[model samples]
Target: MISNSDISKVIAGVKGQINEQDTSLIVAHLPLLEERLQYLAKSFPSETLHAIAIKTNPHPQMLKHLVGLGYGLEAASIEEVNMAMAAGCAPSKIVFDSPVKTRSEIDCVSGLTDMLVNVNSIGELNRFPSEATCTIGIRVNPQVHTGAPEMFDVSRNESKFGVAISSKQEIINAALAHPVSALHMHSGSQMKDLEVQRGALEALKALADEINATSSGKIHTLDIGGGLPSEPLSDRTRMAEYGAIVHEVFADSQYKLVTEFGQWVHAEAGFALSRIEYVLDESRVFIHLGADFFMRDAYTKARPFALEVWNDTGEFVQGEKSSFDIAGPLCFAGDYLAHGAMLPATTAEGNWLSINGTGANTYALWSRHCSRTVPKCIAFDGVHSSIWSERTTINY
Candidate 1:
């Protein structure tokens, strides 16, 4: 777990490197990242492919680090597949899962060495080249809503994500028609109930069984889409529990498991620092980072980001605290990152506000509404810090 002291140490070391114009900083703690990976590795079956989701935090160096750690990358688009390749991940270790894959995109990755493509629908599956080298899979929507936040629930009956289980025959037929060897299911994100995930996997297994019961096609892989709830960095028990559930369900099954977790792998491993530009009425504060970098937090207050304060001299501010509304620089009526967030009472202009649990979706979902420049991201490994991405102008 990255504490305030950990962030302070990184800030003290890299304060000189941060640009004045740069209003915010993103810190990626390599140790925490490794902790998540190690936990998953210990919890899951040895044959499991823990494909880290690139859409969560597509920091290039971070991707490289995960690849070097022996984890695969799950790409939602061909561009992400290319990024996974650029990060030194082999094509065999990448999973392309675009719901709206174009013919050009299909043709682009088809020749890659042992790539996995999980088509979302029968129509998309038909877009694949007949003689491509890539292995195919059909994404199945379990249609079991886990009551995850509606915005993140992809398994809704009317969702546009995958082939609904109501069309189980169509999915099974699609697998039979195409060279599909895998079945994928990603119910939603930030779901806390492991049973919900288990239910979804059970549905996936049932479908795979029906498909494999046929003589022509077989489902050798079960791509359980990643929506595992992210625990605090300090709690290392959820992965083991999740692993137990999976093992209990598929102990005798021969299907290979492929997980694509985003927040669970990176959420607590990173933090965001934004300079306070104003302190209005001692109850409202304005920050340099707004909806541009924190789209989900701004749009929905479901994000569980912890807040902290630091003085200009890089010391953690820890005195009496007060409730304050944190507002971003974006010009919108509902651009508040947090309502009544507690912070040091003395927090004022120039003081830095630290947002914990931002290592996952915050920066990756960066919006261009305000045209704010992308901030610099620095990776820290407890010994040294290096810039993962430098702050730059938003190129239109």
Candidate 2:
């Protein structure tokens, strides 16, 4: 775990000739990554089910490592499902979750395995292939919103993620009438409160009880979809707390409980390294580096209340720490990372700084609007290190 001071020291000794085209290098501590995963796995164990949401950082090697550690994959698309499979994940260990599914994607994965599908509507339930032996899970909206406004706003009544709890009976009726196999529910992404999770679990358990009562098919699986918050700066919910919550919720139930987490598993495994391109002002500095336009990689996306500043050197200049803005090299004004934040006074031009505690595949969400090549990715397994991905130079 690199400390903020260690990062400051690294920036203090930058001697390389930093350029705009030069790839901003990143180093992933695989041992730490493995350790974190193992800790979470052991903390929850099979008693409290856990699955890796594939959307966060789907590098093949990362997925392979995670799957090898007994974590299941939660795939949102056919491509993600294929990626998980290619990474040596068995279809039985994959959960095909998406509110909207195309016929082709459904047909392709239909006969693969008894993977869980998170259904959101009756139409999706009706469209499921009857021949496919699937453990069906319905995403119920608990209507209990948490997290930042951006995250909370999406879980509002108008949001299109899951079916309302009031309408859950309709979903259950449709499921019982069809080839349903399991029950699932997700509140929203980046949820921090335990009560929110409890609410979601209560809803799922109620549905499970109803299914067990009225239907011939057994509800053997309960998937508590992952929205576990991963705030790099603070601990929202500890692994043990999450474990306790799960244990309490399913104490009386016989169903297998499963959880899908993306950010929680990979957020602190890697860092995004960039160099300070130029100092925009005395208080505001511009540390320019290569990155996709995704908010997850940049802090600005998650915390809109915080200010961002640019710094040429990763270190902060003396007395100018409180007012700074960090921006990427993209042409758009919204291509900023952090703003109005404290920085080191010693920061200068040509210094390399990292978007500390990020993942190797942070660029997965970036777009090619300005035709910039994707950044490179490197993985370090304590003693040995290797380049996991080469820099993207193509302009398509």
Candidate 3:
């Protein structure tokens, strides 16, 4: 994780570079991202394909950075697949897990040799070309509710994500009918319980065992979707424990392992900087960013982020704190980043705020309702900060 002091140092160096017109900036720490990769390496098997979800931070430079680090990319759409390919990810290293892949899109990815395509539904399985060289699998919703946030959970009985394990016969028959080589399951993100994850994996393994016993073709891969809550930055004990669970479950199995982690890989590596524009009544503080860049945090109560204040001189502000409603400059009333946010009473209009834990699912989900310019991002390495991408305008 990137420390507040680390960010403060970077901001102090680049404070002059930020002009009066710039309202926001995203700081991505390469060292923090590398730490995530290191944790994943320590947790999973050496041969496991740790496919980093591209949706988290689709910055072109970030994509190329991950690919160059020899990490696989998990694409949720055809465009993301193309982006991964363009980033120089090997065809075999890309995993296509889109829920609604059209026939044209199917044909596009099916021709790629050694690609793993996990069909979201049984009906969608028939859309694939009969003699495609790419490997195929069916995504099974283990139906094990992990008590994850409702919006993120896709393993319910009637969920639209995958073939439910309740339809065991249908799922088994589909695997036998198609040239399926793997089975996949993703309960949801922000799931903190390891037992819930264990249950889901056990369910997947049971189905795979049954399929292998009943079918002529054996299941060779197990795509246990990544939903394990990100561990605290202080230590990787949670990851080590999760790895222990994974080893206990599949240590003796022949199936290859693949993990598609989005938030876990990037959540702590990035943070956003927004300029405080107003201090209304010393309670409702308005910042330059709101629903446009913080879609989840503004609209949902689940995605909470931490805030740190820095004065106009770029020095960290620490003193008596007070409760304030941190809001964004959006048209609607619901566009609040946090209500009753505790901050230094000295926080003023010229102060800059760092929104922490925004490295994932923040900017990539940028909304166009307000027509705000997407913030420029700078990658920091504890020593220097460099421009990763320029601010983007929606006009083009």
User: On a 0 to 1 TM-score scale, where does candidate 1 land against the true structure?
Assistant: 0.95
The sequence of per-residue lDDT tens digits that candidate 2 reaches over residues 1-396 is 445544443333332432366446554667667766766766553665567888878877778888887778888887898998899887778998876788777777777867887777767776767887656776766666655256434456777877777787687777678777777766666677777667767777888788888875477887877666554322444665776777777777788878787766676776656656676665555654533634444534533322222245544435444456777777767666766656666566765556666662365576666776666666666544466776767665
How many clashing pairs per prediction, in order?
0, 27, 0
RMSD to the hidden true structure, all candidates? 1.7, 4.2, 1.7
The alpha-carbon deviation from the true structure for residue 14 of candidate 2, after best TM-score superposition, in angstroms, is 14
lDDT of each: 0.86, 0.66, 0.86
Off by over 4 Å in 3: 214-217
Give me the runs in candidate 1 sitting further than 4 Å from their true place.
233-236
What TM-score would candidate 3 get against the native?
A: 0.95
- Superposition TM-score, candidate 2 onto the true structure: 0.84
Model 1 per-residue lDDT tens digits across residues 1-396: 588788888777777887688678988999988987988877888899989999999988989999999999999988899899999999888999988788999989888857889988888877777888887888888888776888898888999988899998888778888888888888898777778778888888888888888934377888887887778644556677788988988988999889999988888899888999999999999998889988987887747578888876679888999999998999998898888888999998888898888888888999998888888989999878788889978888
lDDT of 2 at 9: 37
Q: Write down the TM-score of every candidate.
A: 0.95, 0.84, 0.95
